[model samples]
Target: MTVKEVKKGNACALLPLIIFVALFIGAGVLTKDFSNMPLNVAVIIASAVALLMNRKEKFEIKVSIFTKGAGHPNIMLMAIIFILAGAFATVAKGMGAVDSTVNLGLSLLPANLLMVGLFAIGCFISISMGTSMGTVVALAPIGIGIASQTDIPVALTMATVIGGAMFGDNLSMISDTTIAAVRTQHTKMKDKFKVNFFIVLPGAILTAIILGVITRGNKAVIGADFHYELIKILPYIAVLAAALAGVHVLIVLIGGTIFAGGVGLADGSYSFGSFLKTIGEGLMSMEDLAIIALLIGGLVEVIRHNGGIDYLLYTVNSKIKSKKGAEFGIAGLVSAAAIATANNTISIVVTGPLAKSIADEYEIDPRKSASLLDTFAGSWQGILPYGGQMLAAAGLAAISPVSIIPYSFYPILMGGCAILAILNGYPKLGTKSKEVKQVATVPVEE
Candidate 1:
């Protein structure tokens, strides 16, 4: 493509996203209430801007591109998951599963360590599920209930779930972000995991410590009337176990829904008609989140097609000089892409080639490059209020996404550690292996 045709660093191409931030975040700041402007309305306005900016393309073509993005396999899958998660959550709650599970947890763990325990649970579930969204879907309701029963703010509790979810997203071997990072940088998954584990371990520990300290004074008061039922809690246990066994997340949620429904039926919690109605109610509850995801998908696709992402890459690529610079560039590149796409795996896949090139030029370790890419992408995903992780958690908890940002301690710490790694060359950068160097120019499969 010709230089003019490439449209690198074209500011106008990013206007839609800029407008979105201005409308969503700026409006919140001005109004002093983040929820004053609904997320869907802001997205819709920005999408219209994107469509208007692409005047050169036929209206039909533009609509087709937006539709393609909205209907992307990943986006569609997330939409389906949202519906299933809503059903599972509603049915499980109707069956008294959430309360029973919460009471069981309260009975087992010390009151003061509740937040820490929740964080740990989120970490385990996300690592097992290999998807932060899945982890959030599974645990957010319980987190909500725990927060309501304790002195903890609901936002802080949800943030804990987000922080832990991102921890696994960055480190899990089966995570899409991990797979993309490893393959793009020509590193083995195990090597990348080893490097990633050490780099982020300190952050995780600090987060846990912070959570404990903050929550130490806020002990939960378990009510004498609260009782646990093992049968009611089986759905959650079964879902966690199935996820750990490498079952597909969709199947896990569907199975959980069915299991919870059966429990409700046997217990006479709801008749068959009522059970079906509850499922419908749950699906309807997820309507807002599903619409927002679709809008974001379409909006992001337009930005990408209009050269916004290319411009971001061009700007970041122009500044790299030394190995450390390249490392930071890779981190920044993926972070920016994640901000634009609202999906870490997609960001990694989009920027992996550029990151590989930067690594090769600087002779940086593939493991390090892979780790940086995954770490930064995951970190950004955790912070973006409109991103799926936070959105899913917020939707499930019936809270605003912006409220959860400040308490996302683990993700913030992870980002800090990533910056430190780039500056200090953590894990000790070594000479790039010949095999890695040879494959540096190869295209990676997404």
Candidate 2:
């Protein structure tokens, strides 16, 4: 059977996405419990709706499209990473790594500076891992434990971690968002980083200061005799060391898992069978996220095929004229994609080509466009209650994702700074006046 092609700028093709938001957000609002409706369930429903919207095509052909999207290289890679992260986190926790790390941190940091310290840790871990979700998986539990021990609110503490996680997500050279942005705009990674760093540095410093001042009175209650086994923390150290040395995330996680199991065995923390059980359970824990990601992937592919994404691109393109407007348009594109997809890296990938076109048309520097894409995508990703970063943090902390939104100071500040950068052309090195036409004309490598 011949399949009917969707026309570009077909707004009706976006109904499935609207249906998804309505069902997901509406359920949460109606139930007054955002976690009551499982995200996978919502995504499944949305996927079905997306499938139904493709009625003009043969059923088997539609299924193929959905399957292809679900099995996209990027989606599969992310699924593997989620599985590895879960196993690593659970194995490390079983081996007492998290508690030991928390104890060591508490012993070193003053009580009043707990929030700032945790934020810094989150930043460091995310920068090393080059993934916000991995950083959240490693740090959220510790942040929760810290909150339980101190007067700091769990939401506030987790928010600090989420904020810091986003900080590194925006700036890390190895981050998927960074790679997508740089490749899409045809800019060197270092050039993008230089522009991104100066734009975000003020926000990071301001966030740290804000966290410190707010938690100044909440001193941690650490006992003088608390014992932390250094060996138990080796897994995390190894992971960080490998990640900082530019190892792939999957390798880092695999090595970390084995190291944690070895440490557990040597310390007699559990039997070999128990170690296997923990790893299995950890992988199982990520089932919901993995499933939801796949469903979202498939659904987005359907939407793209139906011209939803093209509609978005068309809408943004029609409104761009001046340099500031072009910057705002790029930011708007990525931000909208982030909100729609609930994944920053995917958002960058989806919006990158369109953004590059806008930059070329408006004489905006490729590096600045790359920075806008990464920064705005991260900014939106951090605050979205259903976004992976917030979901992971909330899941680990056993709190509502909504609860963390109010305290996501760093993401909020980063977004504000991004807007200011667009408005005032902050970095100043890549403005239209100094535009390198050759950079904008550079071919984007697929």
Candidate 3:
């Protein structure tokens, strides 16, 4: 199809996405139970609508488009990461790593500092690992354990993990969202990190102070008598080490899983049969996420084929009136994509090319564009009740994800800073920067 033909189909093709959103959100609102409507079901209905919209295409052609979307390299790679993460998580839990790590961290912090410490540790781990989900999974249980022993509210404790996870997610070089943004905008990761850090750091500090006050007089006794086998912690250590070495995230997760299995076997926590079983269990645990990922891939593929993304790019870019307006547009684009995808990395992937195009058209710095992508995506992911980061943390803490949204300091701060920076043009694109000319035109790369 010609570009004009593609453009003509964009709006019509995108109607299914509107339908999906309305059905899913409306259903959830009416039922007051988001889970009442299965995520995959919503995607399936959306996909059907997309199929029906392509009236001129043969069934085979439409199926081919769907296949292309489901098989995108980035989507496949994420599936691998999810599988490995599941395996590592299960093996680590079986080895008592979770308990040990929780106790270890709790014992180290002063009673009065538990709230601050949780936030700090969450941030540290996410920054180290470059994954908000990983950070929340590692720390939320500890927050729950602490809450059980202390007078602190479980929801508040959960919010600490949420806040800290977003703090690191927004600034970490290894984060998938960061990687997607930098790659898409053709900017250096270090440059983006510098901009992101300054914007989120103050909010983190203020959050620490606020949490400290709220949790005052709720000190819990952190016992030190528990025995911990250092070997059990190898999975997390290996994951962190690989991420620090700048390994690809999928490979790092797979390596961690292998390490965790070896440790589990060495500790006699699993026999060969049980080790294999653990892998199966781990894979099974990720079934929900895997399905969600595939459905989203297929659904978005339909949307892309119909021109939804192109329509967005055309409409959003054409309205840019100034540098500040362009920046706000970029932020809104990334935020909208993140809300749709519910995964920051995927959101960046979906929006990054368009953002680069807008940045180039407006003479915005690639680094600034990348920073906006990370900042906005991280902000939305952090506070979104249905987003994976909050869901993972809430699940671990046994709290409502929405309960943490209002108190998530880093996300709220990031959003505010992003808006302020855009308005003030604080990180102005350097005229001498090579990327100012290089990143103006962005096309979806297969």
Candidate 4:
């Protein structure tokens, strides 16, 4: 057995992750700008720290350990999906799909339902785009516009946008977080989405009602202010529909890209040259995430090899007895990862493997674990002051991120709903894991 495969875990194995998080959040806190600390750089430093530990092993063995984790099939597939999803998204947006979809959602909104409408729109756009940041960036200005026209506070309006963005982020078929959660837990993306969507639906509805009450008597004059081409919105709808129908993700993305590019060409939205260029730009946009995944995988492998994961699991497992306790442990794990990273996608990637192991150990359904991973991470990332989603929304609205916290009804309610789901054991995907009994037989046949 290796150092990591021991009956007793080594507590010291966790130092690398601790140091990385410290550097990341510490630098962000000091600079008051989380973006100042590049995740790639911090992870690289942490990885080096991990390599320096347990130096008695041959250097080749140490390098092999990192490579083993970095080259994991799940991690490799996730990077490919990220790259493909980015390309599809870029093509769709290049064809005016995002703008048209936004315009269409807003144009249909009843003037009195502005706040709830924005929330719903945020959800739709984020779901289609598979990115909360993209949704926030696209809708923050619109939220501000609506706020200026109505009695709603910009903070509340912006919070609504953040809520909607996160809702979709937690459940979007193509979201990297969802992909990571599903891939790591070995569950189908559609299965995870279905479970995650229902789990958070109540919270979303309640949030809408709350926004409705808060925005009562307030009118948003968005009439005739935006124009949309219905045809331009087809690609998003097509991709979403196909994915939910359980089509292969790669097919959905590639087909969506081709369809969107054809539309863009026909509409003169972009030339053939521009279409190729947009694909390149999209791929580039995802490079950081892809690279980060590889580095994190390698870093985490080193940690795991040193028994950090085993120790953490041992600690969590000690207090968890029943299935409910296991679920709670998973929730706690997801939430802590989110709190540390302040990015839902990164948090999911950071905790995915560990969550899977916990699920297997407890025989908890992988789907439930996946849902918790996405939902909890989404819930926490939105309300955090230093999170990119909140920071981006605040920056666009020219308001304090702190002000947005009071009105972040969706994510707060989301966390509550997730807890309730655990308490009730919703979905009841009865434990599918069982211990294998090795049957021994003498060589009687010989």
**lDDT score of model 1?**
0.76
Model 4 Cα lDDT, one tens digit per residue, 107-163: 889988888889999999999889999899899999998878777889998999999
Report the C-alpha displacement of residue 118, candidate 3, in angstroms. 2.0
Tell me the whole-model lDDT of each prediction, alpha carbons only. Answer: 0.76, 0.76, 0.71, 0.86
Stretches > 4 Å off in candidate 3: 1-9, 125-151, 168-199, 213-220, 223-227, 337-371, 384-406, 421-446
Candidate 3 residue-wise lDDT, 349-404, digit = tens: 65676677677777788878888898888888887898777777777877788887
lDDT string for model 2 (1-446, tens) is 00112134678877877776676567767896455666567778878888887577987887888898777665565566667777877788788876676556656767678888888877765664456887788778778778888878999988998998898888765466776676667666556777888999889999999998988888566455546998887777777566646565567778888989999999899799999999999888767666766676788788878877667656665675578998898888788878766778767765675687677767788878989999999999999887878888887888899999999999999999989998887888833323222222233222
Taking the tens digit of each residue's C-alpha lDDT, what string does model 1 give over 14-95? 8987787677567757885556777678889999999888688998898889998787655565566666667776788788
TM-score of each: 0.65, 0.72, 0.78, 0.94
TM value for model 2: 0.72
Model 3 lDDT, full chain set: 0.71
**Each model's Cα RMSD:** 7.2, 6.6, 5.1, 5.5
Write down the TM-score for model 4: 0.94
Candidate 1: where is the Cα deviation over 4 Å?
A: 1-9, 111-202, 210-226, 321-411, 417-446
The TM-score obtained by model 1 is 0.65
